[model samples]
Target: MVEIISIYNYVMRRILLIQGLIGLSLYDEIGQGYLNEIDLECYITDIIPTLAQVSNHLHPSFERFYVCTVVKKVFFFLDHLHTRRIRIKDIVSSGLLSQLLELRDSAKSRDLVVNETGNWFSMPAVLEVYENYLDLDRDHDGMLSKKELSQYGSGSLSPIFLDRAFEVCRTYNGEMDYKTFLDFYFAMEYRKTLSAMHYIFRILDINQQGYLTAQTLRYFFDGIEEGIKAVKTVK
Candidate 1:
């Protein structure tokens, strides 16, 4: 159900969210700058249209870095919103932050934490990852197939090695959900020290793995070398 709210309330809610959620204060650099010659309220009013236009509008720089702290603050708030299932689409049309406050108000009424959706997701980090997966899932079938997963490899990672990684994931369970997707993805990308390395080892085990064969090691190094090149290029 769409909640029709007053415009004044909407403006005030935006102000509050700016202060409380995004953690921005008119007394700070952002309030003093970027919003040149205008008061904080007026600045927000001007950007209300832009805010309404973009859902993942957090941390916007327009290529400038001075106000990046403000950007991070905004993303932190957006992540908080996402965790509560209050997607950006739900409230951007209300002129601004009123939707966020509206969700806050609903939670207050139900004696819950900004959600009546019942039972907060157990894994918030995974939920954030799932949101990324949704972006990756072009078909939107609620499952990621090999083609969808391959988008991460832009001719840098060895396609054959990726297939083997997929095999290692499939060995555990064929059905792909957020959980196994994390298992697969973190193993390939996150690079944290854990069982994900075991998955890598399993991939290297070609023909009973040939004692970490030269070809298998090269496949892994190819991805690493490409990643280093990309980072250096960025630098």
Candidate 2:
């Protein structure tokens, strides 16, 4: 039964890819067969109104923010290397475009759509992520300083972890852009993915080496211990 289910899902995914390609073909119309950031932004903006019809969770006032957040997510995942553009093939293969298209179906309940926390294109999920970013940007600077980001998620992440994130991940001066923050968020939230693991490993590999050594592990472990002690002291 498991094998059958796997095969069925494979077929359905292929069909979804084909459907996504047909729907998105016009966006890559110059025969470039890809979408640069501006092209993708326009495409997503055009579809937002249709998506809004079924997205009772999204507010009219927040549609612009929602669109910007979703576009950033697509680039973060599908472009993977921050390339500023993506091939339609990659978009279709990632199934994100298909997932966005699926939201157009009025048949899907608002509860079901909003609860798909793992789906990047989910309206409620994107809004939640955007809100979190806004809350963290206390300075209204549109970017997160180390002090601002340290307050993320109960403030429990080790100082060393954040230090390495700023060191290894792309940042503007000493602050992290929303896109880079999304990368950090994804690494922490979906640690099982290869990309996420690689990101985490990069931060942990303090010497810029390709692999983690026992010394590296010990260094972070010590940082974690100190963080725990500090948290306990506060209580």
Candidate 3:
């Protein structure tokens, strides 16, 4: 049963990939028409440089192109999800969503160089993120040890969702090992956290000071608070 579900997921992912490629190819043409009304310059040269920079940042190996291809595939999947208005939170449980978002926020904080006192995070902080995620597994299965939990539903998720996850987990042909399960869980969670961290680091270099300090930290925290409050007010 688990094998069947895994196969199903694999197939769905492929379909999403194909659809994403189609969308990406159309993006430039569609974007141009949309941007035409605006005063912004639509020069391909200007756009290419930005793309080159981003591509370089994402991949240092231009000659060994498979890395770029894989990255594009992943990007396509994410773009499709966004275009479809499918929240990552909806695909995974709220607990997991919160964890991902928290990691993203922490990454942002780190990037913004918030808490310039060098108290942003350390080894212990990193472990805390892992521990918090494990605690959400609920079944004490040593890992998230479930597929549905990693795949579908939201909020606390229903017992039905958990059951599905467990069922999917059990479908493996061989007895699953702990390390393998942990690898799967951590890989997905860590990717989200790392992506968030990268962006956070980019925006918070206020003083060009190699490290953040107390004042910078306070300013960053206050800004986050204001943003959150504004979001809440609008909602």
Candidate 4:
């Protein structure tokens, strides 16, 4: 009976690991080729955890090994996308995101958060986005003041990008609130027009608050998105 149980556990773990690799491959293909600027972030934050959990459960020895693997792949895919300047929509239409999400429930038994760091290593891209936004809000107020926005890199942003971002923010009917600023910032960074801006706003506006204060934004963004985003941004 004991021998049988050990074999069963080993086989199950192996199966889970295989499933995770398959899922990661699918995500890489889609993320590298299809996802939109906004959807890319969503996919990273939401779907990657599901994959990591599956992998970890199957391969328990590595201590979040599955998550670490997924994160590395995600970062590579994003780097390739950026290098090629690929359009995110093209990737989505290819049907990869939906396929990846389909595996989420299968891996529900495993905890995506690793005990070592108490962090989700599977979704580094999400982390990067959260960190970038949080870094902008130095004062840590719920809202981002104009002073905070202005201090983003001393001339690191090109004149064209800065002017364009500023112009977009100005059109928000006032001094560009946090939501408006994030929308513009993402649009510029992702090289998407304003159409993608709406998605960015929706993702950041967790808690259905209709407005994203730094606090609420960080909670959801850092909790989920940060891990995913971290994958892409880390050097």
- What is the C-alpha lDDT profile of model 1 across 37-146, one tens digit per residue? 12323434334333322212323432122122222222233332223222333223323344333333333443432223222111222234456678767889767766
Cα shift from native, residue 153, model 4 (Å): 4.5
Please report the candidate that would top lDDT against the real structure: 2
In candidate 4 the C-alpha lDDT for residue 42 amounts to 40
Reference-based TM-score, model 2: 0.77
Model 2: per-residue Cα lDDT over 67-127, one tens digit each:
7777776776676555678888888777688778777756564356445666567776876
lDDT at 28 for candidate 3? 40
Give the C-alpha miss distance for residue 121 in model 1, angstroms.
Answer: 8.2
Off by over 4 Å in 1: 1-124, 153-156, 171-175, 219-235
Report the Cα lDDT for candidate 1: 0.45
Ranking by TM-score: 2, 1, 4, 3
lDDT of 4 by residue, 119-146 (tens): 2232333344445657886767634545
Residue 212 in candidate 3, Cα distance off native in Å: 0.8
TM-score, one value per model? 0.38, 0.77, 0.21, 0.33
Deviation of model 4 at 122, angstroms: 5.3
In terms of TM-score, the best-performing candidate is: 2
CA shift of 222, model 3, Å = 1.6
**Model 3 alpha-carbon drift over 4 Å, by segment:** 1-199
Model 1, residue 125: distance off in Å is 2.1
lDDT (0 to 1) per candidate: 0.45, 0.78, 0.36, 0.45
